[model samples]
Target: MGFNPRDAIESVKDIATNAVERSADIVDSAGHILKGDVSGGVEGIVSSSMDIATHSVYKIKEIATGRGDDLDEIV
Candidate 1:
């Protein structure tokens, strides 16, 4: 059998997508914990959700544009 680069890239993309999703879930859960804080609970939840949502979009955009493994994606 021959190596198919597209399949390899797709595999990697799947892995990365899953990782991002799980991390987002963890972060979102943290927001729930912070929601009980009296001073900044709402702010924490809002900021955390917005950051995760935007960053998720950015990562998907990078993958769709064929720059999934670029250093920019890491940071």
Candidate 2:
């Protein structure tokens, strides 16, 4: 049997196309999963930071005014 260059080229084209399609699917899935993780982590950090800030401000105000309504007074 004689080797045909045209047949070889066609075979390579099909394999390359299939590989590209499969790779695209993997990348898309990984991006979506990573995006969700990053988003949730950022939201949690922001919420915790806000809570700390609010508590610190309240404590400072009470201390500066010498108010008996400080957190210690309430608890």
Candidate 3:
């Protein structure tokens, strides 16, 4: 059996093509994961901020209407 240089070159090309394709896939997957994590974090922060603002507004309204007074008046 004789070693053919052409066959060896073709085999090397195939290996290189597969490696490049796999690397691209890995990078794409990582990008998707990062985007999901960042999106979730931003959503959480916005939700928490809205909840705090709602509570603060409720408390302000109560105080303004004298409903939060703790002192008793002598009539």
Candidate 4:
């Protein structure tokens, strides 16, 4: 049997998507377990974690695009 490019692409895509979904579920579960770590509080921990993740992603994009400090100073 001959190898088909379309079928190969589809198989790879399915594997990648499944892996991503499983990893996300694990993170979600961990977050839920820690949501009340601060005497049943949920603000400081979750909010700060989300902010850091978002900022890191934004910084990565800016640096990757060659914007560096210029984009930060402008924004």
Candidate 5:
């Protein structure tokens, strides 16, 4: 077959388009994974902080009412 310039240009264009599409897909997948990991980490940290705060408040209440002596029993 004859090597036509127009055909060669079209082939190059198609290859470039495919490469760009694949790269975009890879970036999109990576972004989703990173977002999920960050969201989960943030949720865990919030839960742990709330637990610590609740425990601290309970301890403060006990100490204020002279029930600190029974701390071990309550726990």
Candidate 6:
């Protein structure tokens, strides 16, 4: 057995990518169909969703790096 740095790096990348994709999906599915204030503008929802995805990716990066301190700022 031996340490595989590439494997670890790939794992982290996968986690971050998955987190971002999932976050965007969640926001698109739920945040864009409210039929209320801010719902009439798709651009606004998309911008908000990108913000959310960015936050989610940051949180995932924190977790992947084993430094989740102050993660509350994400949610």
TM-score of each: 0.42, 0.41, 0.40, 0.37, 0.41, 0.39
Quote model 2's TM-score.
Answer: 0.41
Worst 10 residues of 5 by lDDT: 60-69
Which residue pairs show collisions in model 4?
A: none
Cα deviation of 39, candidate 4, in Å = 20
Each model's lDDT: 0.60, 0.54, 0.50, 0.52, 0.54, 0.60
Native-structure RMSD, model 6: 6.9
Error of 4 at 74 (Å): 59
Give candidate 2's error at residue 59 in angstroms.
Answer: 0.2
lDDT by residue for model 2 over 1-75, one digit each (tens)? Answer: 344556555545655565565556555555655778666555555554555555555544444444426675555
lDDT of 4 by residue, 1-75 (tens): 344556555545655555565556556656766765543234444554565555555554454444435545656
Residue runs of model 6 more than 4 Å from their true location after superposition: 36-75
lDDT of 6 by residue, 1-75 (tens): 233566556656766776677667656656656655455446665665776666666655564554555655545
Q: Please list the Cα RMSD from the true structure of every candidate, rounded to 1 decimal place.
A: 6.7, 29.6, 31.5, 10.9, 29.9, 6.9
Best by TM-score: 1
Model 5, C-alpha of 23: deviation from truth (Å): 1.2
Model 2 misplacement above 4 A: 1-36, 68-75
Worst 10 residues of 6 by lDDT: 1-10
lDDT of 5 by residue, 21-61 (tens): 55565555556557786665555555545555555555454
What is the overall TM-score of model 6 with all chains considered together?
0.39
Error in Å for residue 24 of model 6: 0.8
